[model samples]
Target: MSGTAGHGTVKGRDFRLFWFGETVSLLGNGIAVVALPFVAVLTLHAGTFVVGLLTSVAYLPWLLLGLPAGAWVDRLPRRPVMLVSDAVSFVAFVSVPIAACAHVLTIPHLLAAAFICGCASVFFTTAQRAYLPTLLSDAELLSGNARLQGSESTAEVIGPGLAGMLVQAFGAVAGLLANALSFLVSWISLRAIRVTEPPPSPPPEVRRRRLRTEVRDGLRFLFRDRILRTLAVFSAVSNIALTGMSSIEVAFLVRTVGAGEAVVGAVLTLCGLGGVLGVLVSHQVSRRYGSARAVVICLCGAAPFTLLFPLTGPGAGLAFFVVGGVGVGAGVVAANIITDTFRQRYCPPDLIGRVSASAAVISFGAIAVGGLLGGVLGELSGVRETMWMMTGMYTLATVALVCSPIRKLRDFPESDESLRAAEAEKAVP
Candidate 1:
């Protein structure tokens, strides 16, 4: 009912619509997370490498198409891009069930579906991140991000267990069908939104720039800023380690930890519950501890608990993973809310798409590589050992944050006005 610029809490009608859509989409994706690999491993009898490849393929589009997608999103209406992405995902997901029902499903078909949906995500996520600023003012950005993260985490908490149940009761195909239906719900919610988006504004010279140049410009902008550069590198490295650990987690639980399918799903659900708790308190923690300091505390401080994961074994020892996961999930979510809010407030509106894309490219690319690495390492060193090694790598990645300028500051820089004032003061001498 209002323009793109609305001010208030996240409870506003416009923000609720966006949040609800994303929550359903995330829940669908969560179900598919378990369902997808199960289809390969159980139905098709694929191996570890193939299961890992499924994840790698889904994220590979971020590396290949991320830059161009960002520039394209900058030039288009974000909502339309999101709608098209949802439609693409819907079709891709729906195809899997159809093929399964017809008994024509093959690994190649699954891979193709994953790759196509991944490409859709590349466009959709870039647009959505860029579009959020349009929906809320700077002051509300933190609240908005926290609320969104909470909803997503809530979905994560429920999705996996549901997936496990559906897979057990009906089949993995049932989860895929649920995911397809979720996208339809998301599309409808997005269509019903009443906020009017402003027109895209590429300057004459910018419009004339080559696609390569535009992509390079986004990369340049991210690297030119010290804070953005540091965070980007940190996130990339962290993703590599996190993905490696996650890629093997299901296998580790089923084989090494000696847990059943339902148990594994429950453990992962606890991880999401931790994320929800983190989001619930993130705003207060940032206000109390200082957002900049909170990032360091949440990340570097909590990472060491990853050792708990490696200590996990059969029966009661498995609860170690639940505790470790809670720490990691809570810490990571809070830090993300702080950093994302900072990025939104600090970056220029026009460049937000490119900037967000540039960061996502590296981070998501690392996830792809990490997935492959996990598979290889699992084969070579054994799954439990690989988890230990990857956890160490993740813990070490936090060193980048400690070395960055952000470590020395109480609060991260805020607003273009504050940035300009600080620059002017520096030049006064």
Candidate 2:
């Protein structure tokens, strides 16, 4: 019931509520991830390009609204922003099943729903990241992030198989309804929290600045910092490849690999298991090898496995996809936990929202691009060929990290002053 601002642990009532709500929400999202594409492909008989476009539409809001949402979230109450976002998402997802039941569902309708959910996700994710630090002390962030990521990964494991069964028994629309309900739970959980968050306190000069000025300040801070900038660029490149491959994964599984709905879900579940494993070991990995080294090790080690994707086929060959996915998923999730904790600790409190948004705009915007590219390539080239290209790009993208200043360091700097001191020391040589 009490506030957890300076607490060294994340076991406070408010945090538990937050975590439970997020875990359920993520489970629903996992279901929707399979449901939406299956609906497009099975119910409507959509082609590869349309399916890819659907994925892109779901992420386009990050490009369209990310900056402004971050700016506004910084000025507003973060919890309320998250609540409103959840409400909006609930409406958007709930509409899908309603339209399907009415027999009025169309591709355009699906696209519209995806766009709306994407917009809500932008604000909700931005605000949630900013709100988390308030619930735990600096030392608690790593453990908290690991727990949250672990829950998310667990949802990924359960949700796909559940979605497959729901689609098989009831219908694809059933999955959407479940997702809609999850948002409602999240809304209730957020509302029940008793902790009173402090109001935003920008410096006098910052307070007078306009929205654009505030956004610019965040971007400047993010880019001016060498480590943050390097990580952002690496994420941007990696996301493009990752999203591109994912955009067409369902199509490839169904068409190229001859996987049924249940099989598709099963494969994704196995991959999610890898993510869970990553979360379990992320702390020890970072502690033993150092966060900086851990990130590089995870990414580079995972990159080569992507080559296995293009080789995936039916029967015994399906093992290739499973193996590749498990490796890549584990590495990406582990690296994300470290980097997310780093950003939360590294950025200042007042500017965390903007900084998070700025980083996301670059990193997540690439997702839209990747989705479109994957679809177009799937249409132009074969799905298998496109997979080859995307996976190859994914492997090559690691070079950005290998060459960055982070490669020279063991652990990441705790603050900008420490970073500057390190840079000065390096310069003297």
Best by lDDT: 2
Q: How much is 142 displaced in model 2, in angstroms?
A: 0.5
Off by over 4 Å in 2: 1-9, 426-429
* Each candidate structure's count of clashing pairs: 0, 0
Clashing pairs for predicted structure model 2, backbone only: none
Clashing residue pairs, candidate 1? none
lDDT agreement with native, every candidate: 0.86, 0.90
Question: Model 1 over residues 332-356: C-alpha lDDT tens digits?
Answer: 9889989999988887788889989
Worst 10 residues of 2 by lDDT: 1-10
Alpha-carbon shift of residue 265 in model 1 (angstroms): 1.3
